[model samples]
Target: MSKIKIMKKFNFIIQSKGGAGKSFFTYLLGIKHEQNKETLFIDVDGSTSTSTNQLKFLEDQKRIGVIDLLDSQDRIARDRLFGSIEEIAELSYSNYILDFGAPESEQLPALFSRDVNQQELKGFAEFLNSEFIFHVIIAGGTAYGACMQYLTDIVRVVGEEFKIVVWMNENTLLNYPKQVEQILEAANALGLDVERFGDVLSGSVFDTKLSTIIQQGLGKAGIMKSGYMIQTQMKKLTAEIII
Candidate 1:
């Protein structure tokens, strides 16, 4: 741990609907990064349950993996949640990527609830502010436009400082113009800090044998060519961050 560098902790402010590759992205993170026991994934998204099941089912056997960290909505009440998030920053780890619940995901409840008052929002914001890594990821589809607007509004009340990252998730398909535009429009409406917004790590990052499993699950085959494909824009962005 003494040999590792301590940088600001970051949370991936992630948003999306089911089947938009959130878990797939996390699986890739698992594939490439070193796993430290000190690290913790604060899964506000219940996707962890199903995603973990998928991972296990793929092996056709029992599996002991971090994917099981996903908690139910009822478990969100734990005080240790914030402590775990803080530890992710303080402990030795290269990065902490949090995959938040999708707007339509029923398992993970809403954050900006009418039932939950401002006091709760402030507490949540304070916890996130204290986190060494704080970030956000926006879903790219035009369908998710309203949801993005909702997140911007939520972050505004919570505080606009979360490290927001927009994932364009570009592929050959679609009547899509630009995913970035959707992200910008929503952020602009809520007056978020977007001067230096992060780049979309194109879907190509999911290139591995595990990715093949994902494609097969989706009833597709060999979606992305084999090889390492880095998101150049994000690589440069991260390099700027490193120095």
Candidate 2:
């Protein structure tokens, strides 16, 4: 039998609005990739180190390494960000997951639009022999419009060679099913891949309970250990995502 090909790719989770579940999705993706590959988790979100904190459990295992691009003022050092990308490009053997803060949604797309940055990103993809996929989360309720606009902006900047994945957050889906449908339609119209994330149970008692676990730094594993229901939900959600 012919050997099945293992696809290698870099996944970037970026969104303009805070509380849109960027870190949560990154955590889920990390769990999905942990078993089979040596993955590098880059926490570019200077404003909040949620992803980095969540993945701390892997540090002892040497499964991941982090690059802190933030200065004392909690701002991203542009030069350092560029330099780090170059450095990471050299480590072509491992997969990468980059979690960008809300502000970076604007900055990164602008950077990617530049001819120089575009060439660098394309070169990295080639050098690493991997595909680059941008994961944008579109949540329901008040954040929906801003999230969709961010998605549009990303589509405008990124070239056709790159793939875009739209993740629909289920927390507010019940309250905004029509909006969810609209976003799905828009994503389909743009030829982007779409997936539904399990409900995070935000703004509820259960969410409050989960928050306590998260604050303790156990991250996704904490949630998984919480109960079988959450585990099943997470499994279903992550299973649909193609690395």
Pick the TM-score winner. Answer: 2
Task: Quote each prediction's TM-score.
Answer: 0.52, 0.82
lDDT of 1 by residue, 1-243 (tens): 576344435455354455555565544343323223333343445434534433333232222123222345444443444455555545454345555556423222343343344466445646544442223334456445544554555565444433444343333113455655655676676555443322333454433443555444321122223333433332333333220
Q: Over the stretch 157-213, how does candidate 2's per-residue lDDT look in tens digits?
A: 775668889988887666897997898799879998888774766677666765565
Candidate 2 segments exceeding 4 Å error: 1-8, 68-82, 115-120, 203-206, 219-225
Worst 10 contiguous positions by lDDT, candidate 2: 210-219
Please give the TM-score that candidate 1 achieves against the real structure. 0.52
Clashing pairs in 2: none
Superposing every Cα of model 2 onto the true structure, what RMSD results? 3.9
